[model samples]
Target: MFSPTGEIVADAQRRGVGVGAFNVITVEHAEAIVTGAEAAGVAVILQISENAVRFHDGRLAPIAAAARCVAELSSVPVGLHLDHVESDELFDQAAANGFGSAMYDASKRDYEGNVAATAAAAQRGHAQGLWIESELGEVGGKDGAHAPGVRTDPGEAAAYVAATGVDALAVAVGSSHAMTTRDARLDHALIEQLREATPVPLVLHGSSGVGDDDLRKAVAAGIVKINIGTALNIAFTGAIRRELAVQTSVDPRRYLRPARDEMAATVTRALRVVTLL
Candidate 1:
């Protein structure tokens, strides 16, 4: 059944588990996430990023429709999220496009500018009955929170949430995006500190780099929503590459099936850490 992002997140919070929010680049990605969710018997989020909208030719309606259908058809609970949204127009499309929640990314702006922009975005989201999430500047390696030595302050995070009225905050402790290696160290004490200091649920971006043991520890420390992208991409792309190297047929279906299955397996394993661990 389709679930509310807030409900899933709140439930995860109450249970001391991290809710996995998997990024959906294609409908296949959404399908695989749901399959993994069902296998784990957990409610998972399917996230469509602003870049993904552009990749679908600057129209969110089609991708949104497909992802929504995938979520609606899932046997397990699933929620749709618009992730890393930088444009106000895109944020405006969240509710209209069937997204239950959105992450307004104004972290590239100056601190005050981020606050102002994110605050306005949060207001719009709240008025539309959408759960809104925001980050405190860059957190790690890529665009969606990854830079060396940059970490969110507990005081500033609390203030940002208060200033923006966002439902959740993505803070950097130690993790980089697009990391193939799963050895990124995390600051569990800082996570606990932030959890204590901030009123809303805590989110962790660029978590693909975090190892399984560390991921479990982070959730235990107080991370509610964990964003994972690179890991799924790795599984999907690697499977496709291997299939193409051996197969004579050029049909996309033949390759994509294995690719999607590989991603599903990766998702199930990752979900187990946050859920069953």
Candidate 2:
């Protein structure tokens, strides 16, 4: 059944487990997410990122509708979320298109500006009856710029959540975006501190880099929402590459089927590891 992101997170909080939020870049991605959720018998979030919207020429309706269809057909609860959305217009579009929740990212702005913009966005989301998420202190390696280490201050993160009225908070905890290596180190102590300081559910973005043991620990430490993107893409592209290398099939479906299956397997493994189900 289709579930609201708030309800999914609340269930995770009650169960002391993390809910996997996988990024959906295509119809196949959406289908794979639902398949994996059903395979694991666990609830999952289908997230569409801002870059993915742009990839579709800013037309989010088709993919959003596709995800909603998959969600409705799934026996397990499935939620749709817009991830890392920076514009109010895009956020509104997601809500209009039936996304149950959105992460309004204003992390590039100054602290006060991020708070003000996220607060306004949160109000708009709440008015639309959508759950809102926002990040404080930009996660590292966004757009290929990896510099001095950046981590979210537990105190500031708590303050940001209190000020923004968001349903979830994504914090920078030593994970970098677009990491091909699964060696990112997370500060479990800080995760616990942030959880203790904030009332809302905690979100961990750029989670593809974190290993399975660390992910289980993060959930145990209080991260309820775990966002994954690159890992699925890796599985997809790797399958496509291998399929093409072995066969000379020109049919797109021939390769895409393997890709989708690979991605579903990855999602299933992640769900089992993160939720320990």
Candidate 3:
């Protein structure tokens, strides 16, 4: 029963360091995350997204509750997070489900609109004793635009946090969502500038696209939370695909066990890179 209580993020912020926030799509993913974190001796965040919730028939409570259960059972500190959420309704649902933190993404809207919506979401999240994370620039591949080159304005980001009162801010610095490759190049100077400009901790979204060395550099430059989704998915799915292709008549657990182990190793690699351990 080791919930994070924002200790990881707070510690990172206080020391100008970083923590990893990986998205959990299934029980296997949850198990892998906790396993990896304990092995590395570092705290981590387990996040569930809105699209993932939709896939489970609009019921966030069960999955969120499951994530909380995973967090509680882990040996290392964990925080259950809702990733890239857009609606006030779902935001409320996350708090009720016992999420410790969440990211409210309104980057598709105009800057002012994003501020208003994120601020409202923050207000609701804070009321429930939950932490709020908001994004600045839109991560590409969601609306089919694929604007991976967009960078968040340091000045605008500072203003956005002041307006929204978010605990963390995800800013664009050359990472795109759902990337299958780790070729993304981050703006290290921009990250340092943002750290100076904003009061809250900086989160790097679409971090699966970032290579290991660059990820460590980003963290050293003041990124406190790194959000990873596609990398673990790739590991999980690839392991399963490889296993299923080899044996058609095997039990599901036999395949899923390796899948979970592979994903846990992937998470361990990621934590090592970003946490610099």
Candidate 4:
């Protein structure tokens, strides 16, 4: 059955565990996520990003319908999440599209502006029974993410969550997006501070750059929701590259099978590491 994001995260919070929210680009990605969850015996969230929507030529209904089917058929609980959403147009599609939660990205705006936009969106989403998530600052590339000085303040994060009324908050400790490498160092101290100060769950974005030890430590320090996208992409593409190198095949299924299996393996490992039980 499809799980609710708020219910799952709140359960994890109560149990002091972390849940992986992996990004899904295709129906295969959704399948791999659920396959991984079943292998790890954990509940998870399937994230569909704005970039993914754009990649599908501004059509979400197709992938959303496919993902909904995948989640509904899964043995373990699966929650649909809309990630890094910027516009009200897309965010409004959450409930209609079967997404239980959404991450509203207004970090491009100033603090006050971000608060206003997220607050309004949160209000609207709440009316539809959607769990809202937002980021404090820009968790963009290596430059901004790796800068030790450019971290979210504990007090400010608390203020942002209270002001926006988002059910969850993603903070930048030190992980960059789209990183093929998994060596990002996180500030455990700051994560603890943010967890202590904030009223809602703390999310770690750009988590694909974080390794197993850091992931474990981050969860211990207080990250309830971890977003992983690049790691799956890396695994998927690498498997395809290796398969093509070994054999010649025009049929995408020949290559895509290995890619999907590799991604499923990656997701299984991540889910096991982050989930305490």
| Backbone clash numbers for all candidates listed | 6, 0, 0, 0
Every candidate's lDDT: 0.90, 0.91, 0.85, 0.91
- Name the lDDT value of residue 202 in candidate 2: 90
Kindly report which residue pairs in candidate 3 clash with one another: none
TM-scores of the models, in the order given: 0.97, 0.97, 0.96, 0.97
lDDT of 4 by residue, 105-220 (tens): 99878889999999999999999999999998668673444577668999999888888889999998988888888888999999999999999999999999899999999999
Candidate 4 TM-score, true structure as reference: 0.97
Distance from true location, Cα of 76 in model 4, Å: 0.4
Candidate number that wins on TM-score, 1 or 3: 1
Residue lDDT tens for model 1, 1-277: 8888999999999988889999999989999999998898889999999888889889999988999999999898899999999999889989998989999999878889999999999998999999999998467676554544468888888888889999999988898778888888888998999999999998988899999899999999999999999999999999999999999997899999999999999899999998855
| lDDT of residue 151 for candidate 4 | 80
lDDT of candidate 4? 0.91
lDDT of 1: 0.90
Candidate 1 vs candidate 2: which has greater lDDT? Answer: 2
**Candidate 3 lowest-lDDT run of ten:** 141-150
The residue ranges of model 4 lying beyond 4 angstroms of the native Cα positions read 142-145
lDDT of 3 at 23: 88
